[model samples]
Target: MRRIFLVYALVLVLLSPAFSFAAGWRDGTYEGWSDAGPRSIQYAKVFIQDGEIAGVILREYTDRLVEKDWTCYDYPPFGEAARTLGTKFVEAQLAEIDAYTGATGSSTGWMQAVERALKKAGDAKKEKQYFDGTFLGRSEVADRGYYEVVWVTVENDKITGLQVQRVLADLSVLDPDTYEGFPLEMARQAYAQELIGRDNADVDAISGATGLMNMLNIAVRDALDRASTK
Candidate 1:
């Protein structure tokens, strides 16, 4: 009787959702990026082999379009958190893990980046395209020393609303309402109007505000990624 019970438990364990997910991964390397922020964006590269997480590579890109050196002691917390997160990911074989003390923000960013990478590595087909929620996306600092942030709301697979914010190199927020004639403001309105009710960020660029329009597209796409179910 005990032997039979052991066999039954083994069957149940094999059929568990977690076990199924563990067995359904595609063996390969996948990459994902965090939502861009004022200072930097985090990146994760996940290596999967035989349906298991083999390793993870973490990186950060600064506003100046350069990779951050984790070796720098000026921010010891970030460097330590970055290293520890990579190990925890492999050990747990999961993206969700406890945040490192003093580096909660970095930990959250790294986890999201890892989650995105693992999503790409999943072999199972997703039932839904996106999860219904409001997501924030920020653009990489542009050559002109400005960036844009967008709050996107998704419901029933369609975009319901968008709120746009532009930030200068000095991190000052621009008021679109008062800056009516500004090219960036004009571009923001044009793009936001075009994106409403759309499921994706494929929209036409504003002529004089091409650069800003590109930033808008990237920011919108980044938000959509966070909303993605797959």
Candidate 2:
């Protein structure tokens, strides 16, 4: 009986690491985005359940906020990459994997997005008070029939970076450099200055752009909520 008890204890010790590693993920859906290039932004939505990756949805959108139609003839490689990489990540349970040969760029972006999502889903009790990652959030459509999206970056529990985008009803992104976008540009700059380095969205609204400011506040708060450990 003493020998049998010692053997059982040894087995438990051998399996403990794997058990802890598997329990390091919190079950939830998390969304992340890659840095926006001049032409596009990559997005990943990861679903986790029972501490395992359940599914991944990958998407790329043009600079104008239009989703890329990977099914089109010109984008076959991207379509293939998107279809395969998600399954590969789900199977391997890791984001670092072999990239598709002809679609390396898309594969890299998707991988990065997935990595960020997993970071957000890290076990809260075992990790930092706030996840260090990029989180995306959006505001409900306002009375003007437009909405706002903001990407908030957190590092060391501080809001390190922010990018805001406004989408029109037609799905076109507002060009902040244009004359028509002057007000939005002003509001973006003001709110970014106010919110960066702060953990909360308790900044004051910008005058003359009250509606846009409200949308910005809503979006930022949504993002902070996702980044919170509590």
- Report how far off residue 223 is in candidate 2 (Å): 3.8
The sequence of per-residue lDDT tens digits that candidate 2 reaches over residues 1-230 is 99999999988977763353743778999886665555666788989988888899999877544588787838678889877788888887887889999988878878887877887787644355556777666788977777898888889888888888878888777777773744667778888998889888777867777777788888878777666654
Candidate 1 structure quality by residue, lDDT tens digits, 59-134: 8766433577888847899889877789899888888899989988778878888887788778768766765656
Point out the worst 10-residue segment of candidate 2 by lDDT: 16-25
Off by over 4 Å in 2: 1-55, 61-69, 117-126, 129-136, 175-184, 225-230
Q: Which candidate has the top score in TM-score?
A: 2
State the C-alpha lDDT per candidate. Answer: 0.78, 0.77
Task: Give the TM-score of each candidate.
Answer: 0.67, 0.68
Query: After TM-score superposition, what is the CA distance of residue 169 in candidate 2 from its true location, in Å?
Result: 3.1
